[model samples]
Target: MGTITALGLLLLICMVVVGGTQGLQAWISLIFNFAALFFAMVLMAFHLSPVLVTLVTGVIVLAMTIFLGGNDSNSTMVAFYASVAVLILLVILIIPIEHWAQIQGFGQEDSEDLEGMSTILGISYLNVAVSTAILSTLGAIAEAAIAIAAGLAEILEQHPKITLKNLQGAGFKVGSQIIGTTFNTLFFGFFGGFLALFIWFAGVHYSLGEILNDKILVGEVLMVLFSMMSVIATIPLTTWAMVASERQARKKFVK
Candidate 1:
């Protein structure tokens, strides 16, 4: 209740600061994003299907993109769709790599934590582990999509008459820098959050291969790397989509 009240006050502040009726978009974005997030949490809490949960979350994101921006819906929708496509591709790419590296489930130490619980409850630790691996990447994916969309919009605004070739070139250049920083952020963020786990592995004298190839560790690594890849891939994919759409619009005008 307190958190909700805080968010409401924050929304009020944002509305006042932005002035005019601009607060409507913020409210829409907040409502849809929170709805999606809450849906995911409820699904997890209920031990419902992770796949279904992810799907519902995705639908909310799509709805948010489509409805929030009004006049800017086209660009927002394009970016959101492209981001999702890239995420799907990254997941497909990571599966083989994860298997090749033999990373599955959390480390053996966590197994003890599980053993203490009644095994007859039928909760699949492996499912939970894999779900954690996948869900962890969602934050990166969400951020990347927003970044790409915003970047593209800024580029278009700054150079209203920009040619496709120049647009693509600039996107590549900016995207390279963004991707580098994003990957760095992911690496350090993961390391920072899981530092204790790393210490536990080292103090317990786990071998290099054992530690590196541990399921949980590998899952986290894959989550970060693949999310990074998704972002990088979407930059180009989105740029192309924007370019193609503009060209089609011009052609229609000429006709």
Candidate 2:
């Protein structure tokens, strides 16, 4: 009926036509992921620790997204594990960086929108920023992890007798292929989403230094950077995880 509804229906149709059962599962997982994020926000609004909520929600979202992706259990499991590890590492990196950056709360661009509105919401904006950063990186982290893990798993499936060394090399190759695309995806997404802000800066004739110093721009830049770091971290981690899983499986079979 509505434009968004029409677009959503079209997407669903296309996915189902192209992917069949896996597409349906992916659609369902998308809904579940939305619900999970909504629930996390509600919890955060209720004064629950944002960090804790984010950590727990991260695990749940990763499990749902990776496991429901229709990959075999081994691949999904390794992906999930590597993703969680990346999430934790990202959280650690995000907290201190967010604090040091002091980019929390509404920026000047949001002032008109926040006019006559109280900014005091009782919760720490630092935590909120940290949560936001963590959440933003999750997609990239999960994607990289699953891609590398799934690719490695498929290679192993085809070459059942593949050496751990060869499998690791294959994993690295897969990771290399995806890394550039993932970085560009994140960069363009950030730029496209904030093209208006960039135009605003240009219209105001802001210098490069001033533009870089803007709270809003810096915040977004940090998110993109965090995502890139997570992807970089996830590649090696997922590769290790897949190789470790294979090693374990082989040991059990031999025993």
Best by TM-score: 2
Q: What shift in Å separates residue 27 of candidate 1 from its native position after superposition? A: 8.3
- Per-residue alpha-carbon lDDT of model 2 for 1-255, expressed as tens digits? 999789878888988999999998888888888889999999999999999999999999998889888468888899999999999889888999999998887798888889999877999989999999998777778788888988998898899999999988998999899988899999998889999988889898989999888899999999999999999999989999999999999999999
| Model 1 ranges off by over 4 Å | 1-38, 41-49, 62-71, 95-104, 120-130
- In candidate 1, what are the lDDT values of residues 177-221, reduced to their tens digit? 678788888889888998888888989898998877677777777
lDDT score, candidate 2: 0.90
Worst lDDT window (10 residues) for model 2? Answer: 135-144
Q: Rate the local accuracy (lDDT) of all candidates.
A: 0.68, 0.90
lDDT of 2 at 223: 94
**What residue runs in model 2 are displaced by over 4 Å at the alpha carbon?**
none
On lDDT, the leading prediction is 2
